[model samples]
Every structure is written in C-alpha cells, then in structure tokens.
Target: GQAASSLGSDGSGYGLAKALKHSVTCIVPALVQLKVKAHPFAKASGVRTEAKVTALIDGKEAASDTGEVQITAYGISGIPVFQISRFIALGLHQKKRSEVLLDLLPEYSEDEVYRLLVKMGDKRDDLTAKGWLTGIFNQKLVPRILEMAGVRIQTRVSELRKSQLQAVAKKCKRIILPIQDTNGFENAQVCAGGVRTKEVCPRTMESLRTKGVYITGELLDVDGICGGFNLQWAWATGCIAGKASVMRKKK
Candidate 1:
C-alpha cells in the first residue's frame, strides 16, 4: 500500500523545508542573537556618540544627553542577575565587556553602589583592589573600574583625584548597543520568521487560504520563547492538524 506523509518539521528542516506545493504554512521560532558592540576600552579615543550613554550624574541623566535610559542585565521573568548574566554572555559570544557602567547595574540604587565601592576600598588594600580588578577588567585600568563602580573622588583618600575621576566617568558613561545578525537560526534554539499565523485556522491548523491543506508544529508560524512552549506548540498543533487531515479524508 502506498502511504502519504505530511512533513511538519525535522530537527533542522524548519526553515528550509517550506517548499511544499500544497497549501503550506511554516513555523519558525523567533531566533534572537545577542547584539554585539565594541568594548569601551576598544575605542580609539574619547569621541562620544550621544545615543550610547545614560549620562547619570546623580542617578539622573546628565544635562547633555537627554531621554530615558535603558537598563540591561536586569532580571527577565524573575530570573536573577547571575542567571541573566549567563544568557547575556552567551549572546555576546562569551565576550562580556569588562567595564560595565554603574547605571547599567539596576539592582542597586546609584547611592548604594557608590557607598559599597567606598566600603570595599576601606576594607581592602588599594593595591589588592587593583590586583583584583586586573583579573576582571581589561588593561588594568583603575580609573575605569572606579567609574564603573560609580566612585568619584574621596577627600579622605589622598591617592584618588578629581581629574582621574572625570576621565573614568567619561570613558565609563556609555556602552555600545549590540547589533543582531539578520538571521539567527544557527545560534537560536528556535527559529523566528515563519508562515504568518493569520493565514492558518487556529482551531484546525488548516489553511484558510487553501482548502483541505493542513499545517502544524514548527511549520505554522508559531514560536515561543525558551521553555516547553515550542515543544507544546508542536505537540498540540501537530495533533490537531493530524486529526483534521484524517477526518477530511472520510468526508
């Protein structure tokens, strides 16, 4: 007996296998790549791009750069900072910028971050701080570290100066926004651009555009964020489409 099979998806065919002559819908998971940008230290000089920074003077935007500041590294869906860092790093090709500006750290208020750094300085030796910083930061740049930590000048500490603080502030004020590649299927766990859902009947996974044709799984332009959602979508849609296709033969 001859058997007819409808292809929903394969491990890697979700994107390329949309060539079915019948009424077809494609399900591509949304693939998001980490945006990449140059590290702060990688800049040739102090030329400033107006858009890249929050310009926080006292937890508020500086007078020069205006508009709302975006904070990254904040939790997504109740995920903690440590966990979010993992994703961010993965997106960034494991190349985390060594100098993260203070404003980017959303967990602490501006004042609290400065006080914490001061306290850290008090408890630890400055040489030890420099040594410790060298490990995590690029080029052993102390001023940049201080600026990232939101530390300015301390009258009590004779070693730190106003000019060095200003330099650090300038360098640490901005981070380049990462650029995402047009296609992220290679790195993405799920593909994004699929058949537009509007064309498919949600109830039966049948093509509203073409009669009696069915679509299901990752072929129907349905994708969800990480978790079991994509799998669930595949299971549910596949079942509905399969049942509908079978029932159509009897009619």
Candidate 2:
C-alpha cells in the first residue's frame, strides 16, 4: 500500500521516474567494464554498492582507521597525505622506504603568536569586545580561530595595539592541524606515491629503472596545490609518458 501510494505521488514518483530515465539513458552506456554484486544483508536493506579495487602502491602495509582516511582510486588523498606522496613516490620507484613527514603548523612563529595575544588584552579595556577582523579572515572562521588563538570574541578590535595586532596576525596565519592519514584508494581521486623521477628520464617520462616502464599521472608523485594544478600535472605527465612509451616501444 505504501509503495503504491509513493508511485502515485507526483512529487515523489515524478522525480524518481525522471532520475531513473536519465540514469538508464545516460549512465548505463558509460559503464562499459563495470561489475556489480549484492550482499544479502545489503539487498534486504535495499542498498546498492559499487567498489573500485586497486593494489597498495609502494607495498606499505595498510593503515588502521584511527587517523583521517580518504579513499581514492589510486591511493589515499588529504593534505598531509598529498604532500608526502611526492617524496613517497620517488622513494618507492627507487626501492627505498617511503614515509610522510607532516607538520601540524606550517605558518607562524610560536613566540610571535603568543606575544600578539598578550598585547590584545593590554590595549583593550574590555577584553570581551569584538573588533575588526572581517577584512583579515572569513567572518565565520574568525571567531573560532580567534578563540583558538586566546582572544575573546567580545574583545574590541580598537583595544588591540600594534604588538597585539601583530600577535593576532601571526596566530591567524599559523593555526595548526595534524595529519591523521591518507584517504585510501577507494575514496582518493589520485594516488600520491608512485615511480620516482630520479629514476625516470625527465623530458620523456621514460623509466630509468625499467625499460618500457614509462611512469605518468598520479603515480609519479608530482602533485600541485589545490585548484586545477593537479589536473594540469596529470595531463602534462600523461602526455609525456604516452609519447615516451611509444618511442621506447619502437626502439
């Protein structure tokens, strides 16, 4: 009865029908080599699932889930994980140990951050007054980051003197967040660690380690800062690798 009612409802049934039609017409065709399977428990719960499996890159043992984990196609993805992947890939290609060194705070000097907070209190009569910070940071993050920096939100910006302002500036610039772990292969968009360039010819992307083994894409360990940089790296590396691979094959 509930299923029948849901099918008859315009808001529910109409939208669902449209989605089904689009999925069938568009999505099905794109999935050329796709595989599907259902667990009995998941089927009973009406849940559908798809999994992409990839081998562990570099042969490092899998990490436990205690830390932050983002799964991806090639491997894990995250700030610390991404940064570390560059060195890891190079090391792996050279058959050396690969590990990531993460810094929780990259920006500020500790003494500078501390001195700034003390000045804010000395300049402001009312320590709780809120002042001008919108120009310096996102308004939403300002209050929270300020609180972390030991400034009361109610403190007036006018109360901050030069030293205090400088201190606050340093803290804002150097907030620390620890790296937990990489988001694993399933959830990651690209792999971090791969073949090292020291062992690969730079211009051609030809492997110095193995003949005919041209490394490219995320497996090469070159990643860029956020935005479209990573995509550009992948495209350039892939193009070079493709050209080099063909040349190697001919030779």
| Cα lDDT listed for each candidate | 0.41, 0.41
151-239 in candidate 1: lDDT tens per residue?
A: 43232333545454343334344333332221233334455345567777898988775677776765655555445787898889889
Q: What tens digits encode model 2's per-residue C-alpha lDDT throughout 69-122?
A: 232332333343433343343343455543332112233355654454555456
Identify the leading candidate in terms of lDDT.
2
lDDT of 1: 0.41
Best by TM-score: 1
The estimated TM-scores of all candidates read: 0.51, 0.37
Off by over 4 Å in 2: 1-128, 131-139, 149-170, 182-189, 226-229, 244-251
After superposing candidate 1 on the true structure, give the runs of residues whose Cα lies further than 4 Å from its correct spot: 1-35, 39-104, 123-158, 161-174, 180-183
